[model samples]
Target: MKRYLMTPGPTPIPPEVSLALAKPIIHHRTDEFKKLFDETIKLLKSVMQTKNDVVIFSSSGSGAMEAAVSNLIGESQKAITINAGKFGERWTKLVKAFGGVPVELKYEYGDYAKAEDIQKAIEKNPDIKAVYIQASETSTATAHPIDEIGLMLKEKYPEIVFVVDGITAYGAIDVKTDRWNIDIGITGSQKALMLPPGLSIISISQKAKTIIKQNSNKYFYFDILGEIGAYGKFTPPVGLIFGLKESVSIILNEGLGNVFKRHSLLAKATREAAKAIGLKLLSKRPVDSLTAIVMPDGINSSDVIKQMKELGVEVSNGQGHLKGKIIRIAHLGYFFKPDIIVGISALEIALKQLGVEFNFGEATTKAMEIFSDE
Candidate 1:
């Protein structure tokens, strides 16, 4: 049976991008690869919506996150971290791992971070050096108010660096990195770039570069400054770089505005369909990238996931303590309206097979209506 990937990360890759990945590899140190790398960086800035310097890493998105933390914050320096979900909590761990003190602003899993909360934290600790947050929390399918927080920081704390993990937001959501005053914006190739896992991209502003120059962080491989100035510091992932070029070309060809609208429509259709089937949404502030639905009482999300897999559909289960309680269906990357319809159809069948009581056909019908109007 053919499988459908509807997970948040490692999302479905486009055929064109897959083909690009299969192309003959080139030596990273040569002029040909350097030209491709430079073109890819330019395309990356367009997608990131930033005029800042961008760098590509051969590691996962978490590697860029670590680079942001380790390069910007020094030992004994204080920073603010938002912990609204699994990825949000990563900021806290990274800060602690790098010997920086983290003033964690914790929120409920499905909730979003408020600008006021961050402002309050900064007011309480005026010595904070940086603020780390996620543009979209993948685990909870929630989106934080990065614009509000960034603008607030721009007005109040001009010296403090603003780092955002836009791993799930970059291509799916319109995150105006430069306009939002995000000093460092990070994303992964797998989430919204319509490519396989292997590359991570980060946009660094001039302010962030200056901060890194002043800091004495003890990191060699994650050195952001060294990665700048012409070519990457180490041997780059040549195949993934070629794939990224194709992926960004596809995104640009579709136009970023249309890409975001397509994602929004798919997410809305999915959310409406879930509600029509009597399911509750997990995220209070849902993102366009994915929809997280709370499983019915006494229904295990793992079982639902298993049933969907048996039907050749793949969705993700909640992480950490919420596992087996919530199901996350992704509409990001290469997904379209028909994908959502098929996913909802499979979900309806799975729920019925599990003996859950709900209107069987209404979900698909509602989703079709939304897609028709789109």
Candidate 2:
């Protein structure tokens, strides 16, 4: 069966990236790998829209997330967490795990934390050390307004570090790290970087570096400073790093503006198609990365996802409490207009097969029209 993946992550690696991964491995201490590693860092810096030090790790994005908490905030510090979804709540968990206090500013599943909420949460507690948020919450399929929130935090509370989880937002969306005053930004390779899983790329501001220097956490594995000093000299997943090099090369050749434009257009088309098919969106404020559609009144999202997989098209089911209510269709990374068409087409058929349809071909036709206009 021919498979087309509409899942958010481990999205789909391009043929060129796959071939690059297949190349013969080389010693990490070699000059050749060092050069490739340096060039990869340069491209990553451009894509992140920051001048800070970009560090690559051998773990998933969550590793970097934990690093943010452990390295920035001390064991006794009280941090303000914006808990809007599963991933947002992760900050709270990480804080607790590291013996820190969490002053959580929470919102409902579909809703996002507002600027006022963040301001109030931080202002009400003067002892808050850092404000943690996710730029894009994958579980809720919502993109938080990090730029606006970051600006607000910097203006009102420059002393508190603003940490962001950019796992799903980094490459697909415009994350001007320096411009936004984000102290620490984290992302993984699989999501929008178009590489396979197992690599997490992070960028840290000088301010965050200073704080980390003071913390003196005994983290030898996820140590950002150590990783920076020993980046190219170690055998740190050289294959995936090579894949990341090709992945970053492709992203740069396409240009950042064009990349954003492509994701925006495709996401818009996906949302429109789902709306045309009479599916309700799970997120009140959806983003250009993925669209999470609410299943009809009594329908099970798990059933839908299962059927799509059986049909050789795979999409992700909702996370945590939304497992049976919503299905996500991702438009990030290496996908294009044609892939969107394939996804909506499969979804329409799957809906019809599950006896929950209103029209066939309508969604696909509309998506094609939208793509043609672009």
Candidate 3:
């Protein structure tokens, strides 16, 4: 059986990117490499929708998140972290690891953060230095009110830097980094950039740059100040940079608006398909990137995942406390109508094998109907 990948990150890659990566590597010190690197960064800015100086690190998305936290928050300085899911929980951990005081606003697994809550936290902690959040919480399929929170800080707390982890949001969802006043926007190539892991990208506003300069943060590999325009400050991932150019060009050629619409339609199909199977959704404010489906009572999500994998459809089980409780399916990156159909079909088969009670055929049919109508 041909396998289908339905996880949020490490999504399927298109033929163009595959072909780009197949090319032979080049030395990073030469002018030829410089031209490629510069163009790729320019295109990346388009995808990120920001004019801020963007930098790339040869590390996972977590590296960029750590860079954002370590560069801005100093010892004993307060920062507000929004904890709505596993990824949200990571922000608090990163802040604490860097010796920064984390003022975390915890929410229920499926719930989202309110901007007013962040405002209240900042108001209470007048010495807060920055606000950290996720544009899309991958763990629970939730999208926080990024725009509202960014705007609130822009108007009321201009001095506070706004850092957003857009790992699952950048290429998949329509996140306006600059327009929303995001000082630092971070993402990984694997998530929505249609590439494999190992490269992380971050965009920094001038305000963020100034703040980082004043801080005496202890870091070497992820030096944000040293990386500003050094063109890979360290040896970059040359092959992935080539792939980045192709992947970003693909997103731009499709027109950013069309990409956003396609993700929206595919996500709608997935959500409705899950409901047709008598399963509930996990997020209150779901993002178009992926959908997390609630497993039926007495049914282990791991069983469902295993059955789906046997049928050549690979998805993800929930993380943290929600593990074995919910199944996550992706519609981001290279997915289309038929991909969603196959995913839902495999899910139905898996649930049937597990003896879970649900209307089996409706899920696949619902996905088909939505795609056919579109």
Candidate 4:
């Protein structure tokens, strides 16, 4: 059986990156490591479309989310939070956990948060210090209109920092941090970055750096400012640092425009293929990172996942309330057209094996059409 990983992340790591990681580990405080570390940060900023400092952490994406709260906002500070997916819900939790007042702007699952809602929240709560959002809500498969929201925020409430959880959408979509006026943009290596789960990346604007000064939350390990100050002297995870360097090198070599275009083409192919197979898309404003398809009536998404696994393909099941209702197929990082073809073909066969009335060749044919057009 041919194997494939369609999970959102730790998406397949490129063999080249894996080989780099296998090198003998070196002390991070060494001058050689510092050079590589500095270069890695510069490359991260280039890919993230920001001139701000991009800080790296030896933690998951959640760590960056928490750091955004602890390092930026003070106790009892009010912030507008957009809750449309599991990741959005995480923003709410992180705010509350950090002793901030969370003014949640909720939306039903499977829908994007409206910019107008964000505006109203800011207008209603003039005391709001910041606006927290997920660039892509991976749980519900929705991509929030962050650019629109950012425009409104900058125009209306420039004081409110716009913190985005871009763990899934960072390299997968067009996240122009400087253009969109994003204050603090956070991502993880496991997602679109195509590395393992050990690294979290954060870009902090000069405005955000000011917020950090008054945050009052005492943090050490996740202290981004402290890390940046000591970058040339301190030790980081050397192996992961090398892995990140190699991964970012590959992405840069491919060119950002071409990388995004490839993801877009793969995403379109996946969505069109799903529709041709009579599957419903989960998110209204779907992100290019992954495609979530609603299972047919009486067919549990778990069953679909099980069948797909039997056929040597691995995709993610929905999270939280969406569990057992939708299956998420990712096309991010270390993936290309052939992988997309193989994955869709496996899904079609698996659905048939599970007694779902899907036309066997329809998805593959539609995907081919998409591939040709692209």
Candidate 5:
């Protein structure tokens, strides 16, 4: 049976990146490798759309998230954390772990965060030093208004540091890191970068750098400044670096604007297809990275997932308390229009086999109509 991977992170790797990873590994410290590494960093900044200093880490996206928390929020400091979904909840935990107090502004799983709410929270707690949030919440397949929130902070709370975990947003969506005034923007290799899960990239503003220099934080491997001056504080993942170079090249070659359009098209087709089949979407403001569909009454999402896997198509179930309540299908990196067709076809078959009543033939047809129209 032919297999398809449709998970949010660890999305299918592009052939160019796979080939680059297979090339002979080089020593990380050599001048030859430094040239490639430096080029990779430059390419990363171009894709991230930021003029601030970008740092690459030899860890998953969460590692960069940790760095943002550790460096910016010192002990006894108050920070505002927006918890709209699973990834948002992580921000609150990270703040507490770093010895900072989190004044959490939480919304329902499918709801989006508003900039006005953040303003009110900061006004209530004038001592708040930082604001932490996600650009797109993966678990809920929802998008927060990062641009509005960032601009709000820049205009009013200029002293408050703004950090955004753009793990599922960077390459998939036009995040506009610099224009958005995001002090720390984070993303992983596995998401929109079309590579394996090993590298995490972050962009830091000068204001954030100054804050880090003054703060006395106790962290070793995740030291953002240490990674900046030196190519890497320790031995970098040379193989992944090579793969990242090729992946970023692919993105830049296709052009970032075109890539974002492609993702938007795919996401629209998926959401429209699901709606055509009488399924409700979980997210009120859905992102282009993935789509979360609410399971019908008396139907278990896990059973549908199992049936799809049996047919060689692997999608994901919802995370945390949402498990067995929703099915998530990824439309991020390395995926095209035809991939969406296959995924939707398999979903129709799975729902049919389980005796869930819906217009089976209409889903793919509607998706095709949208693709053609767009």
Candidate 6:
């Protein structure tokens, strides 16, 4: 049976990217490769909406997240982390692992962070050097108000570096990196970029660049400055980078505004379908990248996930404490109207098979209606 991947990361890849990945290997040291690499980075900046310097690493998205911490926050230095979901929780862990004090502001899952809360936290912790947040918390399918928070930081705390993990937000959602004053923005190849895992990206602003210049953090592989100085600083994921160039081109050609609208429609379709089927949404501030629907009491989300997979469609179960409680359906990358319809159709069937009481075709019908209206 053919499978449809509707996960948060490792999203479906477009055929153009697949073909680019299958091309014959080329030597990385050659000038031809250098030109291709430079061209790719330039196109990537367009997607990211920034003039800041960007570096790509061969590791996963977590690698870039590590770099943001290791290179800027020195040992015993303090950084504020907003923990709203599983991904936001990573910021605290990363800061601690690098011997930095994590002044954490924890929020309930499915909720978002507010700029005022961040302001209060910074006021309490006067020595904070940086702030870490996720533009879209994948675990809960929620989007924080990064624009407001970034602007607040720039106006109030100009010296504090601002870091954002935009793994699921960069390509699917509209995140203005330069206008938002994000010092370090991180993303991965798999999420909205529509490629296989292996490439991690980070954008650096001049403010963060200065901190890296004077920091003496004990890290080698994730050296941000070293990467900026050296194209990759080591062997890069050549084929993945090739695929990235093609994938980013596809996104740019489509136009970022249109791309974001497509994602917004798909997400609305998914969210409305879930509600039409008598399910509640998980996120208070939902993102266009994905939608999380709360499972009815006594209905295990894993069971719904398994049933969907049996019908040749794959979705994700919630993480951490939310596991078995909510189902996450993705419409981020390489997804169109038909994809959303089929995913909702499979979900409708899965819920029926699980003996949940609801209108059998309501979800699919609602999704189709949403697409037609769009």
Which regions of candidate 4 fall more than 4 Å away from where they truly are? 232-235
Give one digit per residue, the lDDT tens place, for model 4 in 1-374. Answer: 67799999879989999998998998776778878888888888889999998888888999889888888767898988888888888889988988889999888888998888888777788999889999989897788888998888888888889999999988888899999999999999998888889888899999888877866786777897886646644456688888888998898999999988998999999999999989999888988989999989998989889998988899999998889999999998888998999889988887888888867899999999989886
Model 1, 187-271: lDDT tens digits are 9999999888988888999999998998888998887888885564588889998999999999999999999999999999999
The C-alpha RMSD in Å for every predicted model, in order, reads: 0.8, 1.2, 0.8, 1.2, 0.8, 0.8
Residue-wise C-alpha lDDT for candidate 6, range 271-295, written one tens digit per residue: 9999998999999999999999999
Clashes of each: 0, 0, 0, 0, 0, 0
What TM-score, to 2 decimals, does candidate 6 have?
A: 0.99
For residues 142-207, could you state the per-residue lDDT of candidate 5 as single tens digits?
999999999999999999999999999989998999999999999999999999999988899999
Q: Clashing residue pairs, candidate 1? A: none
Error of 3 at 182 (Å): 0.5
Model 5: residue 130 alpha-carbon error in angstroms: 0.8
**Using Cα atoms with residue i matched to residue i, what is each candidate's TM-score against the true structure?**
0.99, 0.97, 0.99, 0.97, 0.99, 0.99
Name the TM-score of candidate 5: 0.99
In model 3, where do residues sit more than 4 Å from their true spots?
Answer: none
- Candidate 2: minimum summed lDDT over ten consecutive residues — where? 226-235
How high is the lDDT of residue 98 in model 6?
A: 90
| CA displacement after TM-score superposition, residue 87 of candidate 4 (Å) | 0.7
Model 3 lDDT tens row, 1-374 = 69799998889999999999999989998999989988999999999999989999999999999999988888989999999999989999999999999999999998999989999998899999999999999999999999999999999999999999999999989899999999999999998899999999999999999988888988888888788778755889899999999999999999999999999999999999999878999999999999999999999999999999999999999999989999999988998888988899999999999887777699999988998897
Q: Give the TM-score of candidate 1.
A: 0.99
